[model samples]
Target: MTEITLETRIAKSDEIVAGKIDDEFVMMSIDNGKYYLMNPTGSRIWALLDEPRTIGELCAVLTGEFKITAADCQKEVVEFIDQLAARQVVKVG
Candidate 1:
């Protein structure tokens, strides 16, 4: 499994096809033919992944946009991105 660091740049994996439904996101993986459901937060992250951005940048943006503390934001964002990366839902470089 790949570790997500502050410097890691992440983007949506090419194998994923996603769309929005009633304020949430639904995604399908072409590689495995699996579907995923994501909340608004995950959808926002997915949209931001349209272009490669460092994990630090991602966390900073989330912290500013959301009402979360920096420490919590870092921990949660790292874990979330790492999980998505591990599943090949997002690409990390």
Candidate 2:
């Protein structure tokens, strides 16, 4: 398993087809044939992943936009990215 750190780079998978519906971001994984629905924060993260970015960079942007502390933002973003990677919705490098 690849360990994700602050320096880890991430981006949405090419095989993912996504769109926004109402307030949710929905996506389908071509490789896995699975669907995912992301909340507002997750949607924001997905949008940010339009290009590969370091985990620390993501936390920096998210901390400024959301009402969370740096520590909490990092923790949650890491966990969220872990889930996205497991689902093959995102790739980590």
Candidate 3:
């Protein structure tokens, strides 16, 4: 398992295909044939992963986009990314 830290760079896994449904996303993993759902916030994060980004970068972007506190943003983003990592739907380095 990858240790997720502020400097960890993350990217979308190539095995997954994602489709948008309004604000949410439905993702299918071609490698495992597993389906997953991402809420609006998760969908936004997925779209941002067009390139690898450090956790801090993602936090910075989210802080700028939402009214949440920096601490809260980091905490929640880490948890959400962990879920994605657990599913092998994202790559963390």
Candidate 4:
């Protein structure tokens, strides 16, 4: 199994807010004031964002849940993590 790396721990589930916009969903980190508009795949990724998970773990879960290839999940998940990290919504641990 691939090792996972979680940049930041989610402080509180309540600290995050989500809503659907058209066919997509938008999520925000209230504490950091960062906002992300996600498609279905991204939305699913956000749903599993938890304090105890890493990017790799999240990708693994995605593979199992979505029946996607590990390589594809890893690539997309890494990109998503990069964006979130850049926004300061997540930090390297």
Candidate 5:
């Protein structure tokens, strides 16, 4: 697996089915039949994944919307994306 960096582009995996309920996002991996739930911030990231985006781009947008420093946002976002990638809910390139 490729390491996720600031320049890495990411998008939702085709094998994952997802939906929004109220303020949260729920997703299921067709390959494993495992379900996942996301908080508001994660939901926002999921929505942004409608188009492939660089990790840097995601951090930029999220920092603008939330009160977080660039470094902290990048760290958190990278960790979150790593989890999603591991679950095959997202594709990283």
Candidate 6:
């Protein structure tokens, strides 16, 4: 089985808001009123925001779905989560 290093475990997804705008997706946290613009790849991650997922799982999923490098995906995934954290969209479990 794959593992995830998710810093935040989304128990209640109500805290975050998601919607599509034009060709892009946007997710916002009602708690902090902070919004994140989700690109194609980011949107994929957003779609999988039901619960906590390990970094490895995310990396594997992304790599399998897209033609991206695992290392690159890992870095981006961590950075994206960091951005979400900065906005208080997610919290450490």
Which number leads on TM-score?
A: 5
Each candidate structure's TM-score, on Cα atoms with residue i matched to residue i, is 0.93, 0.95, 0.95, 0.63, 0.96, 0.72
- Give the CA lDDT, 0 to 100, for residue 40 in model 3: 85
Candidate 4 residue lDDT tens string, 11-68: 2246567787765778788887877788888766666764547666786688888877
What digit string (tens of lDDT, one per residue) describes model 1 on residues 1-93?
Answer: 667778988888889999989878899999999899988888888888879888889888999889998888889888898888878998888
Q: Pick the winner on lDDT between candidates 1 and 3.
A: 3
Number of the top lDDT candidate? 5
Candidate 5, residue 84: the lDDT equals 92
Model 2, clash count?
0
Task: Score residue 5 of candidate 4 by CA lDDT.
Answer: 45
Q: By the TM-score metric, which is better: model 1 or model 6?
A: 1
Clashing pairs in 6: 4-54, 4-55, 5-54, 5-55
The order by descending lDDT is: 5, 2, 3, 1, 6, 4
Q: Higher TM-score: candidate 1 or 2?
A: 2
For candidate 2, the TM-score is 0.95
C-alpha local distance difference test of each model: 0.87, 0.92, 0.91, 0.65, 0.94, 0.68
Candidate number that wins on lDDT, 1 or 4: 1
Model 3 poorest 10 in a row by lDDT: 1-10
Please give, for residues 5-56, the per-residue lDDT of candidate 6 as tens digits. Answer: 5433433256888888775778777877877787887777766766666666
Question: What ordering of candidates by TM-score runs from best to worst?
Answer: 5, 2, 3, 1, 6, 4
Runs of candidate 1 exceeding 4 Å displacement: none
Global CA lDDT computed for model 6: 0.68
Candidate 2 lDDT at 43 equals 94
